[model samples]
Target: MNSQVFQTPIEYLKGVGTARAEVLKKDLGIFKYEDLLRHFPFKYIDRTRFYKIRDINPELPHVQVVARLTHKEILGEKHTKRLIVHAQDDTGVMELAWFQGIKWAEKNLVIGKAYIIFGKPGMFNGKAQMAHPEIEPYSPEALKGKGNVSLQPGYNSTEKLKTFSLDSKGLQKLVAILLDQFAREISEILPQYLLQKLNLMSRVDAYRNIHFPENATLLYEAQRRLKFEELFLIQLRLLKSKLLRTQKFKGNIFGSVGQCFNTFYHDKIPFPLTNAQKRVLKEIRLDTQRGVQMNRLLQGDVGSGKTVVALMSMLLAIDNGFQTCIMAPTEILANQHFISIKQLLGDDFVEVALLTGSVKKKDRKIIHENLENGKLKILIGTHALIEDAVQFQNLGFVVIDEQHRFGVEQRAKLWRKNTIPPHVLVMTATPIPRTLAMTLYGDLDVSVIDELPAGRKPIETLHFYESQRLQMFGLIKREITLGRQVYVVYPLIQESEKLDLKNLMDGYETMSREFPLPQYRLSVVHGKIPAADKAFEMQRFVKGDTQIMVATTVIEVGVNVPNASVMIIENAERFGLSQLHQLRGRVGRGAEQSYCILMSGGKLSREGRIRLDTMVRTNNGFEISEIDLQLRGPGNIEGTQQSGVLDLKLADLATDQEILLQARKIVEDIFARDPQLALPEHQVLHYAFASKNAGLSWDKIS
Candidate 1:
């Protein structure tokens, strides 16, 4: 592409004056002339055919009609008022209404003059009407550049942009003017040989067709070419980063698997390791043995033995005469890990300590000292572990639990704790779809524990409406009578008009009424509750002191009680699929069979109904994750949203798995042949990457 033209400011464009340029820049991030060229349309409309007024229907998509206006009038008053123009073709008349720009329409639309109008049709009182339709004179001059077979592009715009006439149509005009001036200068980026091999369109033609296609075939090819290029670059960048890190970044070599890991594996393991766990451990062992820093993501559903895998990974560091630390998102989780790990180790296997803000000053100082002197073999804590005072003697391995909760910078802090970044293993209970993992954590090695521990039963999930509350209550009573604790979760702390779900407090009060004081002991926890209080309530539930716990999603991540047999989620429709899955994981942790009772209103949205049905159907995290990705897209998933990497122009991780795989394979071959992309044919690819990622940090997805 022409560098000078692309780098030129938008204000220099023919149609975009100073005022319009400011709006484009602020509202749409369109700063340069090329920005307009690359701003592809979200949808397209066929302009080849015009529909007669009598043939128009609301079921038909956006239609074009060549008609003459028979009458015009302004109806209603104040906010309800609108300008309506009656336009007639050979067969019948249709209403063209404008809710805004009434004065402009009244002045520009001439009565008894032929015009071309295009808009989506709707019914108002049994009459076909179009609101805010595009109107132009029927003369050939009015549609000079728009050809007979052209498909008009419709860009996404904000209301602010519409005020300056920079809506979809307005944007099309600016883009057309720029193309007229600079089409020749828009040189191709993908060279001719590769273009021929892929059967892809030229860069210039792709851009033009992506905006206004000549036909259906051209539009499809244009979209394919653009999506391929975007995904290819992202894959190439990710593979390059992995290469650089492995080749240059130094890692501590755990030369030996010593007694700690052996003893735990042989004598202290609570249960036998699943095949998935054993495989992941083997992968980790191979990575650490390679003498390069390891950045790996350990993803599994809750109760899939991820914690055990993390524990063994930390043991590898300890056996190598190094200290390791685990950073959890919450203090409750940190405490739980500290306690459970000690129990799992069977006492005095390795000196483990917990460090958090709640730790007393004296205990904190000693813990800090032990960490610096390398006496504390393993340490676990919340964000306080990253404080300046918490220095380590040799932080060889680091585990970040619930890795999505920490931002890239926060996780990077642990890397900075030591001179060479530690062999890092980031763990999450949320199962990420394979496509998403390729893009978001593409540079990191991913190991999935796909199987649960032996002899564990899958939680039976059921969906219920409010009218079935009596049956739900009966089930809950049966579970409590069986001596298993229960959890009733709500979605909110206070009621709002926007969401009519039950609040935690109200749910607690209602439960108290249902199972009064002495018969049933209940504890409640929510975001507003004090930390000490929350911990106390959770401990009571864990101890089976309370028959049931009433709370919000605060208990979603932490406080794992194996004996909690029933999980009742009030207004479960309000949660994302992933969240609902996590909440269900809170139960079914023990030997006994557990159940997740999902309760919501009778009227559920289409997506909500699908989510509930999905939960009731299967407990496979991967399957649920794929469905979640399809329903919510990649950005709304736990971690990818914050990275802003999902600002993809065309490629979708949910639907483009094959394209992503091909891109990755091609990149692998390229790297195998030319390690640094330093070859004759690779020069364009190199230059394109450099221009796009001038100062982009390769390791920002920590």
Candidate 2:
């Protein structure tokens, strides 16, 4: 088997000239011979059962029959013309028709000749017929040949490809040609010993059976082998990247827990740290002590005390004589962090400053000067912190809040701020399912703070329909009467003619009418509002100046008002699970019990109902995330759609967790026993890795 053949342009393959090749490349991304080979079937139709013409019904999915073309004719004018052929078996008669490819059908059909037909059955004016069915001359010897299976592989193709005779059936023919000519040239990538241990099919047999399986058992085995191989390669690559980083990068060792960390942990802390928080801090400490640049993903549910853990990690860096910074996705979050951290470190001997786009020139100049001269110990800001003028004296550690909001390239800028790339701890409030975490952040060590801080109550979630609006209003009024503020969130800021939703403006007006202005003050905030105005409203709500704050999802991440005890989400079914969870998190910050009221219309879709039910059933973010993955799939998850590793063809992240775990385990075992994969038995794996990542470098910190 030669690698060069796989790399050959797809246009050079037999039966695929330049015209068809361009269509394949443009539509399906099949530019090379190997790409075509890897384009697996989406489904397979069983052709083994031949149905009698009398038994065919419109309800049947697809059926195959052996019949003869008794009569053929062309009917209608130019655009409406069609070729109709009457076919009959010993039992009954059926009609075969073609509208688009009339000329080809007329030229190919032989009158009174027996043929095998396969297609979906349909009813047309009380007669059974098949539209544009696949017709092949009947041959008993071909059907009886060894290794010939009665399963027909179905592929995905665009309408444009159908015009050029590259539909599913045409594509299947081309694949058969490729396999007939070059199936033997396909190389076996896995070692023989591993294949024997796993009892997996050989590479060539797997490829052949995948497209044209001999039987149901062979197809199952083929799919299993290919899925295992794909996941194995991805896990192996990520593990290798992590190993290479540890071997190549040298981190500044933070070997001491000095006055700053010890004081904050023992005396200045407001409450006792949860066991989850302590565990995460210990993991970060070990990474910093190992002298290897740490790339860790800190996952915690909303209100899980991730910020305290982040601040403590920063204190550890400051204790070891290094400046630290925390980068947030939005200015509101940055301001919140700045204010909260300042209050937590009250009267402590640590200097902190905030830098953002809205800061005045004078303040920016002083902040920049202090940062460059080692006067500022901790800097908290948004994207402005990565500006060229902002230089650090010794930036040893960095924390990214809501890491998914920032692009990978933007995050990389912070890494270059120091001579030695600083240790990175990217924190996210959105819980990632275990399988997604393994694939998306496999190159980085992971830590999860799975519990909330002390005195925090699990938010009580409730579902209400449009008819229950009065009940919801009564609850809000009661909460406001108890000296608690309320947040009323809407999905859409403006009214859409296409969607029947309760917009923000309409909700605000209703609230104003329900609780009049003189006694009940209501604040409004949305994305369209000016930044200063939005800040003013947010501040008023935080200070309990307003009894009700009407807003949109922009308040999902930033607002942390402790006195806000109620979250009423209008059109709650319109939002995703993670977003609903985040909005629910806006409350339950105080020791008092909190409630999240989900209001939806009478007409609820199944998926929408599941989302709301899941929210009401559990406050655990991890449990909600797993259900979210199953419902919406991995591609729609917050940060994983753009990851290159998620471009899986044969494996599904939601349903294939068992296979993924097995692949990861095997990869780990291989690396533990043979670091370099230098043994003779593993040469095949080494070669596959080299060929797969020929021009790529695994040096970036994820």
The best candidate in terms of TM-score: 2
Model 2 Cα lDDT, one tens digit per residue, 566-616: 999999999999889989999999999999999999988999999999999
Instruction: For residue 151, give model 2's deviation from the true position in Å.
Output: 1.9
What lDDT, from 0 to 1, does candidate 1 have? 0.87
Residues 1-702, model 1: lDDT tens digits: 345766788998888889998989998888887677777788887887878888888998888988899999999999988999999888888899998889899998899999888889988887779999988788875455454336888799999998988888888888888877787776555556778888988877887788778888999998888887777778777888899988988998889999989988988897999999999999999989888999999999889998899899999888998889999999989998998898888776789999988999999999999988888989999999989999999999999998878988899898999987899998988899998988888889999999999889999999999999999999989989899999999999988889787888888888999988798899988899888998889899989899999988998887789899999999999999999999999999999999999999999999999999999999999999999999999988977877765678788888888988887887888889988767777766664565442211111121
Return the lDDT, model 2, position 1: 50
Question: Model 2, residue 333: what's the lDDT?
Answer: 96
Q: Model 1 Cα displacement at 664 (Å)?
A: 1.8
TM-score of each: 0.93, 0.94
Worst 10 residues of 2 by lDDT: 693-702
The parts of candidate 1 lying over 4 Å away from their true place are 68-114, 122-132, 137-149, 691-702
Which number leads on lDDT?
2
